[model samples]
Target: MGIEREIKLALPPEQADAADRFFSGIAGTPGRDVPLVNIYFDTPALALAGQKVALRLRKTPDGWLQTLKAAGSVQGGLHSRHEWETSVPGEALDFVALEHACDDAAALAALRAAASELGERFRTAFVRRLWQFEFDGARIEAAIDRGEVTAQVSGQTRREAISEIELELLRGEEPALHALTVRLSAAVAGLTPEDINKAQRGYRLCAQ
Candidate 1:
């Protein structure tokens, strides 16, 4: 039960450009441009009603990943959290090196560019803070992450009571994040290949 965690403040949807400046000073991971998709899942209106809570599934060439991000209350103030994430190649869970720097600049640009290509469906529709989690299991490898997601609207809205559980694995000093990623790619689904990164891939830059 090894899980890694990171948290960041979120810029409003219209102010997403802040992420570009925020990451510019930090990220340095390497990769070619690719296609990406962000999908948000909603609970029954009856469950959350006038509140904000959603499950976001992001699909890219690497594969598909899921996040539990919602506008709600918790131990902290009113902050959103990413409960779980799934990787296809399974090797992505341990790849935290790029994540920290990606939280910086170059990474922000990639996400912004990807989001732009995604168009209105995913544009500055909504914004929430970001929280990331990684988990590895002896029997299986898995993870849970939290990021911004969109609100929901339905033709015939129904309501239900619901709460979700998320999991994540962090590759610490010994195993290394990259090694953990490989392990997680096993039990999860809807993840792609490119999401994987080396343990220190972004270290040099992120440390700055």
Candidate 2:
């Protein structure tokens, strides 16, 4: 499992274009703009959520990827979580690899039991523009996502708009990422720290 350290920021939908323009000239290798559809799963009783675990299947340009993430602490806009992901041909979860990804025996046991009852709860579809940069001795992967999250209910779909900026630390210290955010916030109006993640937002939409 790899630890994920990043900051998530919610952006005004109208400001996305401006942010895109600003990031384009930054020092980094420009990455492809791609679409991503992610389906989040949970048991009927929310067993995994009760234990602070989340499972998802993401459809990207490369292929489907199954990811299992453990709930981690978030302070301000910084988040630190343990994440395990692997490529899969289909949407189904691979229990063996997921179990192997668990850090402890107890977590593995819970995952094993919950796997059988997992079902899709909500989904997020977005177009992501990306770049990888070396800033202040840190390698940060920056992304701008614009799309919507949908939740199905009784044969209908409910949609919520999504526009955010993410800066993930690929290498080096967390402080560098924080420093960059400060700089960007000054240059970009309406840019604020966001503590909620996509999963949490989707869950709230599903509940509504």
Could you say which candidate leads in lDDT?
Answer: 2
Candidate 1, lDDT over the whole model: 0.29
- Candidate 2 lDDT at 115 equals 77
Number of clashes recorded per candidate = 31, 0
What TM-score, computed on C-alpha atoms, does each candidate reach?
A: 0.29, 0.94
Q: What would the TM-score be for candidate 2 when compared with the true structure?
A: 0.94
User: What is the Å distance of residue 192 in model 2 from its true position?
Assistant: 1.2
TM-score of 1: 0.29
Candidate 1 local lDDT, 1-208, one digit each (tens) = 1123321122233333333232222223221233434543222222221233233355666676644333333221112233334453432222242233233343233333333222211211111222233323222122122232222233332222111111222333323333444433332332333221111112112222
Candidate models: Cα lDDT each = 0.29, 0.85
lDDT of 2 at 25: 66
